[model samples]
Target chain A: MSKAAIIPTQLSIRVPVLNWAVWPHDASVPEGPAHGFELQYIDAMTRRRLSNLTRMALHVAGVCVGKTPRVRTVFASRHGELHRTVDMLTSLAHAEPLSPTAFGLSVHNASAGIFSIARRDRSSATALAAGEDTFGYALLEAHVQLRSDPAAPVLVVYADEPLPQVYAARSCAGDRPHALAVLLSHEAVRDLTLTANRSTEAPSGGMQSLAFLPWLAQGESGSWTGHRHTWRWH
Target chain B: MSELKLQIKQLIVDALNLEDLRPEDIGDDQALFDDGLGLDSIDALELGVALRKKYLLKLDAGDASVRAAFRCVNTLAELVHARRTDSERTANE
Candidate 1:
């Protein structure tokens, strides 16, 4: 008898909450001379270490207290640590030598490191830096990892900082760096179904490309284009 | 020195993005690491970077003296003053 290929089923998410920190209609970078998102607005958002998105994680983590502390965490950022990287490079150019602090924080995964340390979570944490398609890619990773162990929940966090002047010149799409994180787990009530299909190009308009909160807030669903990737939610 | 100390305190607040802190809140000699400001290793690193950028001073890994300089904002300003004079001496020589 021929062996049949196993097609994994996606686990359902219960009590899913999406949080965002968006800076719209305000200039995050004023004469910053770079394309990357500036850290100027970080303080504007909140004064806490976790920021807005991580605060959401804290709540989501609470919902799954005992179930958490072991679930894998996936973080996606399109332009991770751009400001710190810019500062480090400029210091190096002058032979000033990068500060150990700046260099450490400049890593793409630094936020995840902070999140892990704060939570005292020793679970697996994955940091991804895929420009444009970061959101869709993160969701896909979460779905795949969720299928690996149906019993465990997966926390997926997506964050972006605004472009600094140098990076802005090259890849400034909009005026905000928004973040959203979802805790995916198996629940009896299935809230949503996600399927993937082939697409030749990204859609240019719609709410799908925006953060999940806005989509939920506006009561809109469907395909949307963000950066270089297309996302569809029905 | 006191004036310089005040400036350094403000710098610390700004660099760390300490929203609720005020210049009067931080005592000059209190430990900036754990008890006082609740700063961690990352804060120390960021402070070092900010200090170097503002004062144009390079930290030497071999020297225990560097720790004394980073002990507090006052100490940092004193170190900057001394370095400035030392550089002047070298140029004159």
Candidate 2:
């Protein structure tokens, strides 16, 4: 990897984490169509239209949210529903009309929007993507939202599947579908610290978001190296 | 239910990804949009695609009769029955 552009890496941020959740925690099963995911949390009507990535993303988001009401959300993904996009592109190539549902939910934040609709939550939510560093940036976003409003909690969700075989070379998913979620607040049960330093190492496998789950849920601290810097969480 | 209605019901269920709903669960006259049946505008467009692909249907979204036919499975069945090829009409019965 070429030298990454210089970025501010000295400002240490401490974000209070209230709760966290992750899907397929075992890591044995790879990211694909088949999983043990259930649909009870999502209603029959809405769940019908969800793709595997969205379903996994929503599952962890729901688990983290639990009965917690009105939490702002930041859903980040490296590739948002790329499978659906591929299918649509294929249809268009043959001069075919695209599926309406596929077109409607192709945006990166579709899962976030669906979560809001399912929760009947009108709170502010953001859907974002930042290449392989999506998880780190989403945490930063949640940290900002929590600092801005001390009263409410912010939900940080990162879900990504291995790029479909066509886009596999650029994938950081390591060929496994994973979603990691953390509920952040100004003051919470655990004190979580985030710091970054410049790095020139080539990006590696494993979802950084899932790697950080251990730090939030149990371990003392962990470091994830990606995109031009190494992010340390404690 | 007539043979055509049953086929349309199956198409509706499959095309909309209505996993929980069976073909029989939908009444012949059940409202299809924003009512008891709980379909939205997107569902309408999806059903339109299903119709076009399966029946080679030519749909006119702006037409008043098209809107009416989309109101219920019974109306949709009728539209399909009227629009299908002669061989399909005879084969279906």
Candidate 3:
């Protein structure tokens, strides 16, 4: 058996094949101000619609519900309910009295809670938010969880939108609404060889030393086809 | 009374961002929950805030009578009218 064939057939599949819902610069809500990417510019891009956190949960339920399988979910949103949060905070600061609707929608983990409600999925699921490092940390957490339960697959969905103007001043990455959902399992018939080391250079310093997860999630795979740090085949 | 109900319906549509919903869509006595407009708990809270700001009506969430006042668009408008009239009488007194 080849080395790839000889590897233990753990249930956690590595880099298990997945699909994406890409959102272009221009979409349905064109006149809704420059929230993120300018829709008119990225007309050529294919932005998936079943892509929002709410919709993603619906899709996950569609995939995992009623199946003879055990799967857990991890949802990552760098700016979870950010637009709603900012609007509520702005109103509160202005002494405008908080909107109960806004307060409920502004919860960071509302997406996760909604997912649970939709699927009635009482299984273990985690919601994570960690700024720019969100994707990396989420992936790491999913990896560790999969290692613990080799039989079940871990579904990792990363979702983020551009921060509002006030928040952008503090930390903004020009990222539009982008999301990637991957099913990770130890049953690695084929998977990426991931490795890393400490470096004096900044994390996003360059291609070789760069963190590819964010770029990859944003559909920059062409630029990182043969890069180092993280390796993915197929 | 009908005019007041219409205005209240319009306010509810706008305040709740019920896109494209017209005043007629909201029946004066229709239930605002799973049976009628499919509103949820959050919408109730938002409606309360909008009522307070737009009508200048003071409402405490802790008040028991609020449940009856918020029963429907007609009830809310009536409550507002009664409250305003009471305030006027007290001011005269």
Candidate 4:
């Protein structure tokens, strides 16, 4: 639980060189092929192994890192294949043998592992889950990695699907599957600053990543206030 | 192709999530791994489970013949047909 009390004046990060989002069933989202993840970058066999969450994450990550052989990656998700986990639990309760493939792909970092395997990427990767602050924390992790190595860009991906119907009563986030990916480098073309502070505000209703979409899509430099912190783009 | 072969082909396609592929598209004799359908070890494990669940067939993971039985659509169909016949014969006896 690292906390940042002061906003550093010299802290800055670049705008995304490539950005992609997928939200197929969201009515507010445009009905088009772009939102439909074809996952053409992954072959049919490998694509079959992915759950919806992994597929979405891999799709956006693939689009962001097109042609690049190797790059650091940060994957963040709130629920992360919760449906698959539920399936595993149901199988256990029934005394049925678990599907080996399903068990292998049920981890929190499964999307990142699949992306690395599909791309044959051997670079460092990180997976984070920080409740309401997952997207922001993932971005900060990517920025830290970029600071360590200024040459290679970092691919940050945030993806999550709606919680299973069994947990619908407890779900706090939106009921749609969504994923967002961005390629971040050290070069400050379009600067963004993240500030952390204590606040008593209630957490937002939807995915934290969605808050940045308006700014990212419109290229508007503005500030977005979150549950515990705020982000500003200039 | 035989109806059993077609059913097995459909099973493979459905069980393995072979997107954009149909039963007729997969040749009866085409290899199921690496070159033809390009399935891998994980897919093989998944398809094996699907076949067992659908057909109630007994499969031994350590059996040497399992690899040969899973080479292609024709081989897999033959294996299923033979196993089903054996099970029926044993019941009749």
- Give native contacts recovered, as a fraction, per prediction: 0.41, 0.76, 0.47, 0.59
Name the TM-score of candidate 1. Answer: 0.69
Off by over 4 Å in 3: A1-14, A18-70, A171-173, A186-190, A203-234, B1-3, B17-21, B33-38, B84-93
Best by TM-score: 2
What lDDT tens digits, residue by residue, belong to model 4 across residues A78-143? 888788889989978976666777889888889888788778888998989987778877888888
State, as a TM-score between 0 and 1, how close model 2 is to the true structure: 0.86
- The per-prediction tally of clashing pairs is 17, 1, 13, 0
- Once model 2 is optimally superposed onto the true structure by TM-score, how far is the C-alpha of residue A85 displaced, in angstroms? 1.6
- Residue A68 shift from truth in candidate 4, angstroms: 4.7
Q: How far out, in Å, is residue A14 in model 4?
A: 8.7
Q: What is the C-alpha DockQ of each candidate?
A: 0.39, 0.73, 0.35, 0.52
What does DockQ come to for candidate 4? 0.52
A79-122 per-residue lDDT for model 3 (tens digits): 77777777787887877777775576566666566655544567
Best by DockQ: 2
Q: What is the TM-score of chain B in candidate 2?
A: 0.89
Cα-based TM-score, every candidate: 0.69, 0.86, 0.69, 0.80
Tell me how far the alpha carbon of residue A102 in candidate 3 is from the true structure, in angstroms, after superposition.
Answer: 2.3
Candidate 1: where is the Cα deviation over 4 Å?
A: A1-70, A172-175, A201-215, A225-230, B33-45, B72-77, B85-93
In terms of DockQ, which candidate is stronger, 1 or 2?
A: 2
- lDDT by residue (B5-78, candidate 3, tens digit) is 88789988877777557889998888776677776666778888877766667788888888677778878878
Query: Candidate 2 lDDT, tens digit per residue, A90-131?
Result: 888977778999998888889999999988999999999987
